[model samples]
Target: MPEAYWLYEDGIGEARATLIDDDRILAARIELPGRLRVGTVARARLTEFQLATLDTGEQVMLDRRPPGVTLGSAITVEVVREAIPEPGRAKRARGRMTDATPATGPNLLARITATGVPVRTLRAHEPDLLEQAGWSEVLDEALFGEIAFAGGALRMSPTPAMTLFDVDGDGPLDVLAERAAVAVAHAIRRHGIGGSIGVDFPSVTGKATRQAVAAAIDAHLALPFERTAVNGFGFMQIVRPRPRASLPELLRDDLAAASTRAALRQIERVPATAPNRHRLSGPVGACLDAHPDWLDELVRRTGRTPIFNA
Candidate 1:
């Protein structure tokens, strides 16, 4: 289990993300953040569409269509495996002897090999989910909304626990809110970001505007997730139960080094591994400690750990 951020420079972009393995990222999709400048930095929690093989072959990265995005009737299944050759006896060299293991199997064996699922297989599996998820009108609405020309980018970070949508805007807060709220909801399905989600809409003070924005949030999130009131701080919170990081994050991190840098800001949530369970890390933890009562709250919320580090 690898943890920490990776930075990409030179020909590649630099961003923070959770490097899951040598080649996989557990953070947001950095490459797709709209209108990249020569040196713009973005942080994200990646989403992925994956097909894992029983033989531990290649993990296919698919475009994670939002829940109500699209689903054709037919689906295809792709399988990749190496033909295992029958076991052969190894010849000993005059100076060296090497033990040979049987190379016979149904899939390829290599120090490194990659495989993927067929596209048709992926397409066929969407309808039943659509039916179960009650997605008819939702799909129609999204299709209609997608045609308008507005320039801004929104990305989703879907964890099993929560979804955090970071909206990068080139427009006013009003425009960003309307478009982004919808986009976040769409992304919820696309990336299947569920659980408790905190949508960070650009802060606004106008009462009517807030109300309108709240209504938009409710309308967009009605079906897939239960909408909670926008908190006092204007955070539109919703909950949609989901699995894990979706597709885009998986690929960018796997293919390049940009994903790791996108995650350093969030690593504090994981809690440091330390010997003192009573301690906490980061500003939030420090604040809690300053106030004895809040410190008690922290203890109540998270069980004591033997070790802690900032």
Candidate 2:
């Protein structure tokens, strides 16, 4: 199988795929799976200048400019032509497959201090994932700890793109909204969730309720999330981190959680209200759903009548 690698040179980024032989570059670039080829190269226009020392032990002038590099700009530099890496060589030089571990797995680490809440930390395994989603430095900051629920509770409900929050005065909903919103931001930062999030505040039947929710949400996000005016419907639409999986999905495997083992004796004994039930029962139903087989095959495996659930 061919493998693609990113190439960065002369301030230009290109994706190069090593052919199956891992020797010659494929020239007939129509399209290939998992491959990146140069589509278009745009040059960046140079402006202001900076003086720097080069590898030749000589001072050199370099270009520094605002709106510097665009889709196409030729950066003048020496080009060294070399063949692709051999399969053996490439195998020996590959970077870490997953990322380096820092502390633990996919959960938060925290310790409370006497003078207010001290600080919280993440397990070591979260850094690479956070970095991949553009949240490396953000996690390092102390501001993240402020977003945890402080003398309050937070409610989270899942949505397709973003999770929705309803702030009831249950326990400082405003502050909870801010904290949960920040957690959502971090979730989005850790995973990429992009779209709209709706935050419903309890009907405050008074002025300033909508603005308060909006301000709280705004303060929690590390990135820009635009909002429309509160609609007549009395629901505030919040734009927070739109990430791939909510925190729960990232934490557990659905398949393992769904599996339940039951012995045939236990399954055959479940109470059935039918007048003359001679077919499959509760445990059999589970087995049929999970592992379907021919009717004869099923009978051979577990000599029990297959009861179809109405």
Candidate 3:
């Protein structure tokens, strides 16, 4: 099968590149805010035991501290966990100070290019291809957690402790469970879901049938994960390492926030001679309205007041 890649930039400093196998998106690399992505080295100051703040204003929890390190002492640390944004709180990272320097190499785009895969910039084709791929629906599903397959559906709910998947649908129990297993695997990878996950498949009576479902999961899913066999109660548990927040967690709770930021970025890109009229979605307009300071800053920077339409 031929592989292709699509790179998209929101023109607002955010970028994402997706790897496509034929028409299906197999994986994606997204750029997130903050400098504390996995494998990045940063200078930090210890504020408390095993906890320190980075120069980027992100707090970090250290796995191990250097010998003789004192409070408020500057030290170099490698990021083991990317910053996860939470509502009404500061984003924090997890890392440890080691003697090794951070390794630098090809990024996702460059590595894909080295493979000679056909890569397309989606800046121009974004509207058409994104719609055709049902990208918005995919985003919605990742955020809201309802996924439909041919024979069944999976409901995902992420919590502080673990992420849960409940499978339900019509058709033969064996077939439905098999299909649901495959779908669950895809959803887990596509949404960047990690950490502990539980899938409640439709219970199958025979041992052979449950084994078949497990085989299907093994065949369809990728590596670097540990999972339990499906039990008689139709429950399977999976554990994947999570270095960062899933894409849904990054975008879901703050879509309006992202939209407002995108709008401001678009405004900055607009030519000074262009008309001051700008259109915004209802939610985006409300978000901007809630922050008059942002609008005032935009006016001060662009020297043009924008007329917003909901």
Which predicted model would earn the best lDDT?
3
Candidate 3 local lDDT, 52-148, one digit each (tens)? 7777676878986656989999877778877765556535778888666645324445645676777766543124454355555666676689989
Give the number of the best model, judged by TM-score: 3
Each prediction's Cα lDDT score? 0.37, 0.32, 0.74
Q: Model 3: how far is 218 from its true place, Å?
A: 1.2
lDDT of 1: 0.37
Compose the digit string of candidate 1's lDDT tens values, residues 48-156. 2222211222222222332332333112222222111111421110011112331222211111112221111111113332223323222222222221225666545
**Cα lDDT of model 2 by residue, 224-246, tens digit:** 67776544454666564331232
Q: Model 2: residues >4 Å from true position, as ranges? A: 1-152, 171-193, 232-234, 240-243, 252-310
Q: What is the clash tally of candidate 2?
A: 17
TM-score of each: 0.33, 0.30, 0.80
Give candidate 1's total backbone clashes.
Answer: 50
Better of 2 and 3 by lDDT: 3
Cα error, candidate 1, residue 117 (Å): 22
> Could you tell which candidate, 1 or 3, scores higher by TM-score?
3
Which stretches of model 1 miss by more than 4 angstroms?
1-149, 158-161, 243-245, 248-310
**How high is the lDDT of residue 11 in model 1?**
11
